[model samples]
Target: MTQPEVEPVSPRPSNLNLPNVLTTLRIVLVPFFGAALLVDGGDSGTWRTVAWVIFFVAMATDKIDGDIARARNLVTDFGKIADPIADKAITGMAFIGLSIVGEVWWWVTILVLLREWSVTLLRLSVLKRVVIAAADLGKLKTTVQGLALGLLVLPLLDPDLPSWLETPGEVLFYVAQVLLAVAVALTLWSGAEFYRGVWRQRHELRGSGKS
Candidate 1:
């Protein structure tokens, strides 16, 4: 008896879904967020606060869109690509804006951005051949980075604030700096791990092919 023919499975069509919309919205907000942060040379307390709110909203949408996509099975290629780009764009803006304002050092921003974009590009390049899930270290790095950036985005240390707030604001500012240090360390470590995973996986794939 002859076996029946099997149809090759076609790729699912990308839809104009809520997750993709949110991802696009995030990218659109990046320039606005940067503008708000840089207003008055990042010295205006009001504008700083506004920028913080915008950053918060953008980050919130990042989480919400991922959750909704996973829950509703709305994941698509666009979401996978655009989502990370949107994330890096907003965070990159924050890092550059903060450095411009003298809140963060130029070297720190340069190192972090280099690591971030390098990792992002490498991952995208090998995405078709290898899949690496988010590790706990990466999650921790993101959380710390976001908290540090968000706190620094606030006008906490602005000298124009009330005298009563001066001490607390300074304290918070230092705290944020400490968190940023930790975040940078985590970022480098996670990047190393990711590269190692890719190397190991590719080696294993080559070994299997040889067999």
Candidate 2:
């Protein structure tokens, strides 16, 4: 008896879904955010605040896009690729810009950047065999880092704020400092988690191999 031919599966297209739109929006905002931060070379309070708003909006998309994709079953290969790229672009811009403005130490920025990109590359290496979803600790790290960077970017939070807000702003700045330290620590921890996961799945990954 002759065997029947098997049909090939077609990949799902990454249409203009809400989640993908949000992801694209985040990527698009990266350069604008960088420009707003640097227009006055991080000196002008107005531009600094503008940059903060832009950064907040971009980060908000990060929080929502994943939820929307999962809830609506709108996940796509494009999203899988573009989402992380968008994140890295915006967050990397923030780190580098802060370092430029003297708000963040270069060493801290370098350490976080190295870990983030290195882990991302590691994930890609095993993409065919496994998909690593973001962990709770990773989410927390991002949240803390975003808040910390926002505080650092808000130039008006210092002596420029009204007396009523100045005290609160100063307090928040100090809080941001603590959060940043915690964020860095969490970053390293989550990266360790990723490697541990990969180690645990080594046998499965080897079996899966390449297509």
Candidate 3:
């Protein structure tokens, strides 16, 4: 893997590349996901299933692109920026959409959203000076969220999920909640660690001062 000299992942894949395109497609689907939930006029209701499936597929792309990029060594500068944006758009909309529909409390939605947006901005700030990619915790959080969101949307797809598994909605919701909580903790921890790394390296940079 050829690393960027100054910035490890600098000049990452461009927005027009395959992975980034997938990310943009996912972001574009957020509104449709919300609309499929909020507004229903028979046919609109049918679209809910499609929306849910699409949501999961979109989320799947997130997982796929990263793996492909890393395994195939196709990671791009644009992927770095676009991937997280896709994540926030999808998650923020779902959380807020559920709140708007009175499914989950707005407070919960806000909490999740605040963590997501804050961490995103934090990454932007930290990445400007340092080169920290997504960490284990962040990945864990995304897994939980994607599963939770998929399950939550599943109900919309099929209100009666396999007669045996009762209370699937609540089950998935709580599971996702737990995962998100863990994710939040990790996000905060990673953010702190990133800053600490930056702080420690500040003097080292001054000593070298190679541009």
Off by over 4 Å in 3: 1-15, 41-45, 156-211
Q: lDDT per residue, candidate 2, 12-126, as tens digits?
A: 6567889999999999999999999987678888888899999999999998999999887888878887888899889999999988988789999999999999887788777
Cα lDDT over the full model 3: 0.68
TM-score for candidate 2, residues paired by index: 0.87
Give lDDT tens digits, candidate 3, residues 75-181.
Answer: 76577777888888987877776666555567767766776787687777666566665667667667766766665555532445556555665576567666656
- Which candidate achieves the best TM-score against the true structure? 1
Query: Candidate 1 residues 1-211, lDDT tens each?
Result: 9999999986674669998999999999999999999999999999999999999999999999999999988889888889889999999999999999999999999999999999888888887888888899998999999999999999988989999999999999999999999999999999999999989999998989931
Number of backbone collisions per candidate, in order? 0, 0, 5
C-alpha RMSD between model 2 and the true structure: 3.6
Clashing pairs in 1: none
lDDT of each: 0.93, 0.86, 0.68
